[model samples]
Target chain A: MLPFARVTVIGLGLIGSSILRATRSAMPTVRLTGYDVDPEVRGIADRIGLADDIADSAGAAVIDADLVILCVPVGAMGAVAAALADDLPADAIVSDVGGSKESVIAALRSALPEATIVPGHPVAGTEFSGPEAGFATLFRGRWCILTPDDATPEAATVRVRDFWEKLGANVETMTARHHDLVLAVTSHVPHLIAYSIVGTASDLEDVTQSEVIKYSAGGFRDFTRIAASDPTMWRDVFLNNREAVLEILQRLTEDVTMLQRAIRWGDGDALLDLFTRTRAIRRSIVEQGQDDAAPDFGRAHE
Target chain B: MLPFARVTVIGLGLIGSSILRATRSAMPTVRLTGYDVDPEVRGIADRIGLADDIADSAGAAVIDADLVILCVPVGAMGAVAAALADDLPADAIVSDVGGSKESVIAALRSALPEATIVPGHPVAGTEFSGPEAGFATLFRGRWCILTPDDATPEAATVRVRDFWEKLGANVETMTARHHDLVLAVTSHVPHLIAYSIVGTASDLEDVTQSEVIKYSAGGFRDFTRIAASDPTMWRDVFLNNREAVLEILQRLTEDVTMLQRAIRWGDGDALLDLFTRTRAIRRSIVEQGQDDAAPDFGRAHE
Candidate 1:
């Protein structure tokens, strides 16, 4: 393990708190400082001992730290970076766990010009948010994708990649643009569609509304879990990653319309072909160990 | 429990096998007969002791039975009903488990003119299909909706309702049109969207296509589970429930576009409000015991 020396993490949401917990577990000797605007979350982090020190301000957290990780929503990256820009020691390896890469890199680069910023995204989280929801094993066996276009120093990228490796995440590097496009299809557009479907179900006539909830098992339950994600965070992800999301949405709309036509025309072969092809990807995800077999039926056990 | 003198089930898919298993456990005295176009499926059902008898054809199954249940694809309801119409014993309570109610009712009513048709749907199933995928408790504590019209005989409807209740299901009655419309939003559209999203992800350029599956937990995994459902069955559902699904899809598309615009404008409030409302519905579904928490993620472990 290449010693992180002193590491600072900003924000204590699901991703932020998870990073703090994982870092503490993996590197007990490394000094860790955490800062979150939410005082209750900060206290939870302290009580749980996720960080060795709790910093009152961003500057207090970044000063003399060898590495700084922006674990906030993509929308807040710029402001957080600007706050700690002057306090960040020169050559501090800066990285992030933001969902969207392009906007984060652009925002952080404008603020922390002196720091070597290596944009990263840990493709892991639960519906729950804040410090209490975090666990040390959140990133275990998951992927932590890093996107560092031309300007990022190779040494800084390597350090951030190594840090992710210690947290039990497989590390891979890609271009910021590619990351944005891929995530738009994988995460952003899917989230938007989920939010939309759930919203539609919620608006049904009162009697049907209850039945919608009652019979959600048919398929609607899955969308609700995706829709349950922190609204502000998802909103920021979509806003920061607008063009890519819209592009993917356009493609999705075309595909949906085509499926609709197949249904209208009673083309079972077309429908079966499309549906069958999608199942292979699910098998791949299962083989890759991204999902488990026990489906949470959205109920508390009796 | 009211005795089922003789119960006939057509099509030995997941829902059919499940109802058969449930019936066997609930009413051991009831003589159960099953028929499917695929003789292999019937052989499996017989081998697994899922039914007391296996019929060679739909006509052979319904003859002399007190209750005949059409459990084929939604699109196949008419053909199955027509085939058995002449052979169905007089005064027999004919019901179906088609995902779409309106079409099922209309087709059965037109075909089985002399029979008491009480259309129904058990709002429960798994991604896996076939007789081997079923369990005796598949319908236990789940909603079994009956959509019989005003003209249907009360005794027939009550008998159908009682059958589901004996199998440990909570039975409710509503208009077939209403059931179709509500399910359009809650089930049909969601399945279509999930299938479309998975299809889009699969079509992505090779490198990204693989990563999308690898990192599916970030929300795409849920879509995959829904998309991975039996293609033939879903294709039939869409074709048979075309009008209601299309109507809901149009509304969903408009709602999705609005959310897309909100994301573009960085309207966190709009996104947050919708997200919060959708979360409440999911909670309500859990409270009603219709869904499980993190259901998609748990499928991996199962």
Candidate 2:
């Protein structure tokens, strides 16, 4: 009853390796193959036996794959698709775990004309990257957004959805443009802001970097965990999802400016009102099982 | 030898109740008392036996205590001290757990001119507020900073330091001004930005609030934990530490603007450089034991 009896994962990074592990754990009878652009990564995958086969090249990896998931950076999706185009099976259902979908979908369509494409983005990750940092449980209980265009066949989308559901993800479908905007607010810009603030904290002349690290438990440490996200993946995300990310970042800047004014003018009520309102969102996020209800994200105090 | 034989914590909120619980756990024989202006909080504390006594008034809370720690909002520290001034035992040392030290020191000095004072800030907390949310291990492995001015007796500072150490905190001494500046980057402004961004995300017209909550796991949830901090406490912090918070905020805004420009102009290299550099800070935080080394803050996936 496997949706993908023979699966191939390209760009064997965190998400790719994770899909391999999850498939191995969930549908062991199904064949799993993985490939990375870096030979070192492929060697590591081989050493770990991450899949039934760690293919030497993209073309060989997808030649027999019923389902092919491109797990490289969004900016590299087209190139990866192009690399495997001639060898890919005509009947193969192609999907991806890219953050930004509009650009990725366009790139993929250009490289794989007439291919069944259903791009997806799983809303879960640790800051760590590379093959070793992934886990079988990463996609469990998390949302995996699938962006399937008009040209994509319903059967292909359903197979991709089933593939994710079998791996333990809740699937939702949306247009690539809407997906980009929603993710811009929730994921892409949040990472960008986290990165920007950490950079700002480190560059401060008055507050030594040591002090920032020591006292980070107050709030900055929460950001450091996020600011530590993979650089190449995130850089490509910003570049690919430019319009939506810029739009959300502009709104955030405006809101922050309003807060700055409130702080400068000693408007405690304005500050308190906004702070109080935001708490309810956190409550809803927890109540909806999107985040841990445990205090401090369940951080151990002792 | 115990540094404090009798401790009174006025303001039965998260930090205040936590101090009482930590004291009971670490120094069982010490006399403890607590008070809050909110009758409901005081009743909850009394019902739970949070301390040896739940005083009805701030004045009655510290009448015979050898140490009094005001754990209310920074803006209320002066009022709490003035309320307890007439009944405060002459030999008692007063301290506070305020985010901004310089203003609190001024307020306490003005309210209790003849009293020995040591101002402290515990760089630790959960997003939850009020008595029932506190626990004995709240301060374990966190930093407690004491800012005692030249006019304050050294013995008073030492006694406060010893008290925090007994509660399993590492104590450090610094000037109140320096403490404010340090926390501005590490804590205050970080909290402000978190609160601001959460507000921004919730107000997005294109994206439904429900969508934001469901996809929050990506990175926004990391911010919600911080944004969920007590409004009254954070409001007072920003107002009291305006100068330092504003200075740090300006730097963060400028850095974010640079990032926006980079993203808009497709400067992936610039974004990658900053994102890569920020990862080192996250590593140092883990190495220093300032934050959990667990990936995704050790959030459970299944």
Candidate 3:
């Protein structure tokens, strides 16, 4: 069954356009309206026929939307939500695709006090950004986490869950705070570390940039893939999820320090134990169908 | 012309068996001898025709070989080299595929003072190990670094270079010390950080194991691929290249600390600048043909 007859997507970038494409493929009968703060993106969305109606403004997009999804950066969620406040239907259920949930939920509640708000984060994306970078299958078999609090209506939560499920995601629910913490560990900290390592490699005096790029396939290339993600989005994620990200970063730094000491002292046993233990987790991820079991992450060698 | 008429590989793991397969494909006339410490590996090598002959022992494998390549973990290089010392031909050119070149070169030189030693590391491998995990094209378009000192013969170094080139690798030469430092930055430290992060994620009490596995596609899955590399090999790499790895690790830790402070202080501009700068390096890597430019590292999503 269709979750909503009229759906509006604000910020028609990767996540927003992806939702439009997936909805078009999955629920062809539902009416779709889309808008982006950038006129260039709006023109591209129109050229691509991304929605049934490409609205001129956020307020125009959500005029009678039964469901309104904000797909802007976490830091921009509040401003974007406020843009549509006066025009949103009283019965509209608002949600967002932000990496951090707590800040987004608070900002959205502040902007649309009388409307139902349920923040969501789909645990799927490529390193690419913008409307053209998205595809329909990006969220297939991936998890979409819904951070809905007790104040949220049960029917609204169920509708959101049903919507994500219809789009080929396995939906799970948790508190906004818990969602922030889990994503901080699983996503934010890893990206921060990847960015740091790539920056370090580029700044090395002895190792030329060309040399680093040449021999990157050795191991550094994997980090570069994650580091190549959208900068503005990541900056907002770290800023909005500061406390949780910092806490996890602290734990990661301590773990790295322990390994550093082991290498300095030639503690082979400690190194081997940790290395062996980590391998099991990779196996579990593959077994759960969360990752490809093929060697080298299923990369084709030529 | 083929580098050598008779070539012996003293270990039948991923690197060793790849050499055997690549040699077979590139130089069909070359007589290949293979041996492994594990009887099961030798049996598998024989069953799979990994070499012209699967020798019963390392000593027997190099008895008449003109070129002998030791493909073993960095920690086992010394013992493996010593095992074939007495039986090695007087004019044999000795080389090894150890990640840490300095120690492997020193160990090979000490174990066979009269023989020519040109230690090399083919900067190519999958996370998988064992004879069954090898392919002829594993080294295709990858860098193969040879660390040959002034005391080493130029002819021997050229011969090793030619062998790798024939196997579809781009070969380069440098000092053993410089090779260790460069690889520590490019490969060793990356692996250590990857292992540490995976370990950290698994040990977190607030996030359950199932949660980590389910949501790993966010960013953690990239680290898991590198962490899933052979434990014994990585353990040996860290121990053998202690000085270089430690130096690089220190730099990485400092970089991480800087980012950590940015996150803690909500310095979104600082975070955005670093993230933006890192994306250029990824672009350079892809432009150099060192990595795929496809979205999500060319991961197949079904």
Candidate 4:
């Protein structure tokens, strides 16, 4: 059964485009309409036949929709929500796929005070961006966390949950603040570290940029994949999840300091102890099907 | 033509076994022999017929070999070299695949002062270890850096370069100290950061370990692959390459601090700029064929 019959996706980027494609594949009878502020992206969506209709504006997009899912950056969520507030149907349920839930939920609530809002975060994406890079299976086997405050109606949250499950996501419910903290640890800080290290490698005096790129297969290349993720999306994530991100970064920095001391003292046992313990986490990630078990990310060597 | 008629490999771990497998495929007619300190590993090599002959001892392995490659950890190179010295042929050239070149070169020189020493570090590996985890194509299209000192004969360096080239690697020569610093930026320091962060995440009091593992697909999992690398090998690398790794790590920490400040102050422009700059490097890595261009390292999404 289709949980959402007439859905409006109000951002035609990677996540939004993926939702359109996934909906088309999963529930063909449901009417899908896509809208984007960028004319170029809208053109691409239209050219690609992304949905049943391409709306000229956000308000027009949701005029007749029963569900509206905003796929914009966390920092822009409020503005987008406010822009579409006037024309949104009175009974339509609003949702989002922002990375940070607390800020997103707050922004969404302030913009659409009377609407039934369910903020969600699909913990899945690639380093690539834009409409062309997304695929229908992007959310398959991935987790989607939804944050709905006490004021949100239970029926609206369930419908949103059912909608995601139709698109192959495993849905879980949590408070916005807790969701933000969890995502800050799992996503934001790791991206910040990746972006920071890549910058460090490129700006080195002793190591030529050419040399760094050449021998990157040694280890630096792994960071590059995550570092290459969409800049605006990541920037908003850090800004919106500021407190939790900073807390985790501080913890990581202290841990790194301890390791620096271990290296300086030539304490092989200390270094070995940490290194050995980390292997168990990696094994669990693979065993749980969160990652590929094949060596080197299953990259082709030949 | 084969670079060496008889090649001896000591240490039947991932790199050593991979060397045996790659050599067998690249130079089918060359005589091959392997040895390891662990009798169990030697037995595994013999049962698998990893080489033409699996020597029972280090001395016996290199007695008639024209080329003896020490495929052991950096800290063990000196003692292994001392063990094989008495039986090594007078003209045999000694080389090593240790990650740190300068310390390894110094260790080999003190143990076998008159031997021709060519230190090498391959810019390729997987998280998996042990002989059974290796494959013949592990070195294909990878970089193998050789650090041979002025005192070493050019012919010895050339022969080692030729050997790696025949095994489908691109060979580059540089001074041992320079190689150490370059690798500190490219490999060693990157590894230290990965190990440190994984330790940090696993030790967090508020975030459950199970939650971290489940949400790892959000980027935490990327760090785990490198963190899971062989602990003994990495411990020796950080210990022996102490100066270079420490220098690069300090630089990375400073860069990370800058990112932390940007986040603290909500400097979206600065964060976005660094994130954008990093994407260019990832592009360069892909353009140079250093990494797979496919999104998410070409992982299977479904």
Report per-candidate TM-score of chain A alone: 0.95, 0.99, 0.99, 0.99
Q: Give a tens-digit lDDT track for model 1, residues B197-231.
A: 99888776633678797677677887888787889
Write the residue-wise lDDT of candidate 2 on B95-129 in tens digits.
89999999999999999999999899999999999
Q: Write one digit per residue (lDDT tens) for candidate 3, span B120-158.
A: 999999888899999999999999999989878899999
lDDT of 3 by residue, A1-302 (tens): 78999999998888899999999988999999999999999999999999999999999999989999999999999999999999999999999999999889889888888889988999999889998987887888999999888879999999999999989999999998988888887889999999999999889998888888888888999999999999999999999999999888889989998998898889999999999999899999899888888887777777
Q: Provide DockQ values for all models, in the order shown.
A: 0.56, 0.90, 0.86, 0.88
TM-score between model 2 and native: 0.99
Which 10 residues in a row give candidate 3 chain A its minimum summed lDDT? Answer: A293-302
Please give the lDDT score at residue A109 for candidate 2: 93
Top DockQ prediction, candidate number: 2
Superior candidate under DockQ, 1 versus 4? 4
List the candidates' TM-scores in order. Answer: 0.94, 0.99, 0.99, 0.99
Off by more than 4 A, model 1? A205-207, A293-302, B205-207, B265-268, B294-302
When candidate 1 is compared with the true two-chain complex, its DockQ is 0.56
Question: Which whole-number lDDT from 0 to 100 does residue B261 have in model 4?
Answer: 92
lDDT (tens digit, per residue) of candidate 1 on A160-264 = 888999999989899888888888887888888888888887775533677787788777877877787887888788888989988888888899989888878
The alpha-carbon RMSD values of the candidates against the true structure, listed in the order shown, are: 2.5, 0.9, 0.9, 0.8
Q: Which model scores highest in lDDT?
A: 2
Model 2 Cα RMSD, 1 decimal: 0.9
- Deviation (Å) of A243 in candidate 3: 1.0
- Candidate 3 displacement at residue B164 in angstroms: 0.4
Question: What is the clash count for each candidate, in the order shown?
Answer: 26, 0, 0, 0
